[model samples]
Target: MTDFQAIGASRKTANTMELIASAARRTVKAAIPAVPGGIIRTGRNAWRSGKASKVAFLVDGAAYFSALDQALRQARQTIWIVGWDFNPDIRLRPKQSSETLGELLLSLADENPALQIRILVWGMGPVYSGKSLRLFRESGFSSHPQITMRFDLRHPLRGCHHQKLVSIDDSLGLLGGIDLTARRWDEPDHRVSNPVRRSPDGTPYEPVHDMQSMVSGQAASLIGDVARRRWKKATGQKIEPSPVRDAAWPLAVAAEMTDATAAIALTEPGLIGKRGHYEAFRLTRDAIRAARKHIYIETQYLASFGVARELAKRLKEIEGPEIAVLVTKSSHGLIEKLTMGNNRDRLIRRLKRIDRYDRLRVMYAVVPDERGGEKEIVIHSKLMIVDDAFIRIGSSNLNNRSEGLDTECDLAIEAETEGHRQAITALRHRLIAEHLDAAPEDVRQMESEKRSLLETIEVLNCRERGLRHFAVDIAHGGTTPLPGTAIVDPRRPYWPLHRLRLRVGRLVSVFF
Candidate 1:
């Protein structure tokens, strides 16, 4: 089958316009030669992204918030922030700076005459009142002339703009799932109770694990382009890109890879007359198919039917890549429990049944709490590493909303040199080690001894406070999805009778 045919995206009675889009993508795919493995090219499955001169992976909130604080401190011409939410009261560097995010931005605006800061977020930002920033009403964003924050209202019903991006002076870019919000700060050690990990209100929250990346050069400018385009769409004002400047990447933080090819993949629901962008979904599917040795995925939600299908097919193969999937133990709230939680359970059960070769592992992490009981460290990161050759990180979850109903952006990197490959592998090992409470080198040694990631994890996992397989920890969500799953975790935009359509579509994807 042709590559596009191999894609064969599941659909529910696609309209003529969508059909035309598929056909057009097919034509484009036909003209361009199939991209070789490990190389990212603009075609059906990918978009054109700029090359990076330097890249660093920010593992936890400590690293992410610190790098972001330094980059924002260096902002000169322009700063663009886009995200699902932000909390102005959260300090980027709690010990180093006493200023809240709002205070810091205000201070920077007051200091620089040329710098203009713009923040764009989902219209429902206020609904997440306790978590997100009050930029509109109480926060000082409305008072400052140099800084403007706008809540984006342009989306299909129930859909949202959920991208986390920061661009400074068009010279540096920070992108990942880590948001500038309260209850989002935690160290790599993931100590259950750290005095510094409390929120602005001094309330302690759960241990959270997340990922972000800092980059410069053409890649940073391209990321700046992404932020500016969204700014114009949310507000009618056009913001021009600033000229690139010398970005002194923060000290003591090491670069993960230098001089690598990177690209941004987006997931945008079709709104108004615009075509939907599902490149993130397509890229995940293709990445799974292309994997030869191992596929490591860490996500907050694991409820995408499209991605489940891709992974199920791989698990059915006798010689497919060893897949290691890590997800949070439960949904955050009651509403999410019925929708995201139930869907995740059913998918996990189905995959476990198809693991004839025993190449699949679904797990979660836990740490010893101060009270001597184990506490589940929230796996808030959305990242994937395939065979040590490719790495992707961003706000895109493995849920239905992230596939097409919500706006998302993910940074994907293709390892270009020996150093890049080694770095990618080291990153995966380090992250896995965090869960195992073992050293990265120990994880690497275990992997080298056991050819299978499943076997490696089994050997290293401690029964008390490390990674636990889903079957041992989480109860099954039943063979069928719970009622109202489609309403809460929609895969497509709401149309007339969209609820009925979504229910029907779920039935089709799961049973067929």
Candidate 2:
């Protein structure tokens, strides 16, 4: 036999062997459990399970606040808010309201003398930005005897309270990445330049996109418990649970799932003799590793080295789930550009090299310019949908801080039943449709015809609205961009001394 023929036969044999090995690896992953226990918990907190009578996904601040306004109007016994920052000057209902947040809360409290309103914000947040100080000075909650606001300062060094949650009457809960503050009040329309996207003083800012998950029933009560615990730690006073009333399910938000179970996961730093919890990290990692077909994720920060390593391992398999990550086009500020931007580049570069199946795609959604200037939208959502099996929505970004440094709360719903599966799938399609500027039904129909997600998006995307591939080549030891630019994005809870601390941390990491 000729040498060329022998080589051709040998190549065929190697290809067959590779196929068999890939199939075997998949079988092994499927058979073994990713998370040994059904629940993801840490030393401090246990995973709580409760039923959600109704779960609704609120896309952007406009939808979220509109629904929240209605719910707050119906708040009876108690109204609780926990956030990284609280701005009373920001209008909840921008079109209808002339009053600030403090006025609205005071009015409700005055009307119902028995109703109590409490707010807990991160202590150091106002010091980081002048906007937060304006919120502090302008939010007249102190004058009202019924309203109480406190700063949470019980975290380890460099950690901050980063959970955005609101629970009313222990019957309704709102949780996700959207904070009730300035620069987070845009609608899904996301016009290239909207007159409404401005601060109280009418200073315009770029359009931002974030998500919130609203729930009623036991799940709401569970989240309320979390808030109460936090308030106790910060205030040294325990608050009683509110009486459960008729679930204040928003009539405007169509219920996506009824009587569904929501898994509550938390991230808490170990401090002052209290154990730390990292359930948010564990839950996310397990979900991604268990995905069989597709894993869709939208996040603000992708700086977790552990998560990137896990994803790279999964991508190394010849055949596995297709990974699609939707991220903001750039870091928000100068410090973030140095820390998060550089870290993100390093992570994606590793993934790019390991993606052997051509199945990994990283992109950012853009609102295309009609007059020839594309407007970048900030993607501040922490969400993931795994093969129509489970969905996670919350304030936890995919970063080291969210994993262990900061405090976070996230909600996950597993599709154990047929109804749950359909709901999860529909939610995924709706989000993709929003990004592509197409109807959810169209995305569903195209996907049902066996088209890949990337293919469907490419076919539907036009010049007006679409997802643009985020180039990872720059991440591959390429020339980095200049830091400290106004156009680059900023960080949440921005640290003034980040540059100095970052240099110190890098030096420590090199030796440690």
Q: Give the best candidate by lDDT.
A: 1
**Model 2 deviation from the true structure expressed as Cα RMSD, one decimal place:** 7.7
- What local distance difference test score does each model get? 0.79, 0.77
Candidate 1 structure quality by residue, lDDT tens digits, 1-512: 42212222211222246544544554443333234654455666565688888899999998898888888888889888898887778898887878888888988999998888888777676577554344546546556888877777656667778999999888899999988888888888887868898988888888899999888888888888889877766665677789647767777678888998889888877754568788888888878877778899999999887788878777655456789999999787888887787788888877765554567777788998778788988999999999899899999999988988888988999887999999999999999888888889988999898776766777778546688666532234464466776778888887765455445434432331
For model 1, the stretches where C-alpha displacement exceeds 4 angstroms are: 1-39, 131-134, 472-480, 496-512
Q: lDDT, candidate 1, residue 228?
A: 81
Q: Which residue pairs show backbone clashes in model 2?
A: 331-489, 332-489, 332-490, 333-489, 333-490
lDDT of 2 by residue, 37-135 (tens): 543334322368788989998989999989998899899899999999887767888888777676788889999988999998887766664655555
